[model samples]
Target: MTANDRTKSTGSTDRTGSTSSAGTPGRPLTGRRPLAIVAAAAALAATALTATPAQARPAHASPPTALYTPPANPDAGRQILDLVRHRKLADAAGVLAMTATPQAVWYGGGTPDEVRASVRQTVVDAARHHALPVLALYDIPGRDCSQYSAGGAADTPQYEAWIDAVRAGIGSLPATVVLEPDSLALLPSDCGQDDARGSRTAERYTEIHYAVDALEPLAGTKVYLDAGHSGWHSVNDIVPRLLAGGVGDATGFFLNVSNYRSDSELAWYGKLISSCLSYVSAGGAAADCPNQWWAVNDAQAWLDAHVHAAPSAMKHFVTDTSRNGQGPWTPPSGVYSDPQDWCNPPGRGTGARPTLDTGDPLADAELWVKIPGESDGQCTRGTPGPNDPERGYQDPPAGKWFPQQALELVHNADPRLVP
Candidate 1:
């Protein structure tokens, strides 16, 4: 489905002030607290009761396959899996306890050594819990169109060196990297006013190639290049960008990183891009190609026809399930005060967490590329300071925190939060 076509669950809301709840008479519904707390508490109680029955059963009463085996990093997968599986919060939490870490941090903004040291500590801690630390790379030049999401590496050269240091931090450990979000699709031939740097298409490709080339060789590092989302660009438009930006060298591409595009849309978009890549490898030109807007019935049909299961043959795709439960909120007429509505638009809700298994051969894995707690930049309605509730600053743009955004996200996801 197109992003606009994806259905919004019954009680979803836009966090931005433009929308209000249906009931509760005049009070400008600030948030969705009462209902979310009730849901979570009920879920927790049900989860405890369900475990009692399971514990009484024989150790191997059910075949290993029938049992719900949590992942080695259950915390990383829980929220998303629970949402996907339609399980109550408590049950998902039970599975999550198996491998949840305290908090997480990304290494950027400091000297290479400092960044490396900090990241190494985080990685080491995650390894201790046998969890895969989710790392987000957000130091690309011209990040967030150089607005509030600005403040990346001073230059491309420094950015590359920073990437090198971050890689060293990972240091042959089990980790997943969501590389330079919005760096691919959001980049334009011209970024307003900052024309001096120009479009680093060639440089961008080199950096992406370098990151993939550097990380994938590591024993347990899985690096995914960020592909914006289904709404931003058509597969045909983006596939060439991927190829130009070193999709050939990376482990694969990631879709819906930090955006609210649905699984069906993501799967279809991913398959289309992958298929186009296949066609290109066989000498098809990206330009002059028709069928740019080819439609599919759903993700399954798209995958069956286009997904190449083998990672090496068909470059795989990973999707971000961070905050996309309800696709995107399109402003009525001219509701946006800022043109950058793409940055944390109001009324949006959290989506599933990141995952490695999508049950589709074409889809290599799904992941929470967007760190939930981190701000998508300053919102038009919220304040811009640190953790400012009015501004909604859960985590600094690219910093670190433990169990960040989960509580607030769960709150936001409640239908009661929506107008």
Candidate 2:
């Protein structure tokens, strides 16, 4: 997901902000609201005994399967604890609830042993809290295509080994794995990816297919391959990539992973993708399926006319709502050579909190795949310099938490943070 960067496209979404139904009735975006610290610990213990994952798990991890639970000691959790120790009410800060839940633990740019250790440490940590972990696998052969977050396995063999290590670390525990973002969307055939005869792109598919084979069979792990987001590709265009990269055996494909499209838009996009896939599976033409660019009424009516799959038969999906509170940024006219709006966008806030009850059956959950505080690399917006003039400061390197940006997100959160 390259730190959840939105594609470089202008659309109706650019004018209107995100429309989230996180706190709406029947949504129940989180397990519970703020409770006393002692009460929360008791609740956690009670949850472990009774909670069950949305899906069953295999014979691995102690007690086998448990529902996704929040670690009581996530960094943000600890930060809130420290605040409370000083008579502050950071616990009252809704960000605490968001931080307490399961989030994707990204593994990239590390040696096999290092990756194993990191993955093991993360899963073990989450297990202590009875929470399932969402692991993002991004160390593919040509990750990020030499862009801001560029770095991946040197070759396919190394990539396969990396996946093996991740699986070993998982060790029969439940996991939601987001495999390789942008690999399918921005293939070698597109843009700067210039592998001759498209061999690199072919290898990319091979690597992803190999990843699917290696990880999909693990006990209760739900593997969601990437389909970018609604703003990036038409459902028909990405459907081929998902199939080529092996989505049939996967739990489903994720949309807007680490990207900031609206929750409502993502829900619609995901439903359309699932319908189109079902349509194609039923011997229908991919060209006939309407995509995100299609008018809403026309697309829904078309699906009604042709799509025969029930909601249960359709593949499920998850959306990244980490920082889409205000949706995409629209820069001033001619502000720079390129207004890299997604890069460290000035005022984006955190979206819905992580939860299982997303109110939509097809949506297994609305996850926070992109960590809120992390910077999206040094965004020059087309000007070449270490400092991004757009923000008037040198942004942190990609994957590093930006305190200033973190504070911004906390302040601008959709539900609004109290502390």
Candidate 3:
């Protein structure tokens, strides 16, 4: 969910309150964490089955499913609208709706009652407008590994309580939940997380399974598990993570949530992963699946030959086209030890506008999961100083808007945002 990821500053008023945290930095890694919890995974399933939501769905409720709809005017959309109104950014005015397209309502951090009140109000407002509510269920324990986006629920029980509040908040209404963006992508073990016998990662999967089982069963909710992105994980690599994290129980999984990767690549990568999943489900070894490192043509050819399941049997997926139109940034070669290419790469532009009308049969939608103009973090890129080498000034702490980047995204929009 990051372009890459760190440090210093009283971060967002949300959780950790720190903008930077220790990390491997630069390109993402699968880390040295062993997924040796096969036995524990089965046990996690048992726990999930017995688990209950923070707020239980009413036993009797036949509410109609909710569909996504954009408000004619968005409450948070004013951030960008104000930019246009005051700055006379006439050329980029039409792009206001892109910002207003109702990305997600982050549960950031709060007590259960407070969370319930806020979430209930968000859903109520969206329902009033017939718009689908996109809730980011963030606040899980060990969130962000104490990194820039740090701060989730303190522990499993606390998380469950918060989740219960979330469920209670939604009540009988329909919603789309971007369940914990990096939960699966960056597991505790990856960040040297310590627990008993691969227990931390196991708990994460358990927590995810719990949420999926709870949310997916609701009458009007779709839960999309995290798949990181095409650039991050191989099809074979991620399929296991997905399966382990309960993708079957989800409406589908999400890709490139807050990173930059071309739609063509993301779509192709998604198809391969989905196909590989079907292959494995039918008893093929995960190792037999084609991966991102394979040549594009060969990958497609592999899927054509091996995946036997009909399209409907395979899981569906969504892509975050938030800021990938220009793809990722490339630094001049031999510049530094690490080039965190994903974090706030300069010159990136907005990709396709958010829409549910993706023509691909398996793609459920293309969404703006990452709020456009938001900073990935203070992208030092290993130069070791306040200012980003890519951009002269030190960028703001993560999640805050980067006005120059935002303007660049609007100006260089691929199809060009026209209202």
Q: How does model 2 fare in lDDT? A: 0.68
Clashes of each: 19, 2, 9
**How well does model 1 score by local distance difference test?**
0.52
In order, candidate lDDTs are 0.52, 0.68, 0.66
Segments in model 2 whose C-alpha atoms lie over 4 Å from true places:
1-3, 10-98
Task: Order the candidate numbers by lDDT, best to worst.
Answer: 2, 3, 1
Candidate 2 minimal-lDDT segment of 10 residues: 11-20
How many residue pairs of model 1 clash at the backbone?
19
Query: What does candidate 1 score on TM?
Result: 0.65
1-419, model 1: which lDDT tens digit per residue?
00111111211111111111111111212244534533543454344334221211112222111111212322335343543244333323422332231222333378889878767766665555455666766676655455444556777788878888988987876666767766666553524433465546666667777777777778767777766677666666778878877778777788766567767778777766777777677677655332325545553455455544554588788786656666665654554333233444445555654455568776866654444433453334333334423334433332222233443444455232222
Error of 3 at 173 (Å): 1.6
Off by over 4 Å in 3: 1-87, 91-95
lDDT of 3 at 205: 90
Query: TM-score for each prediction?
Result: 0.65, 0.81, 0.80
Candidate 2 residue lDDT tens string, 172-206 = 66678888766777676665566668888888889
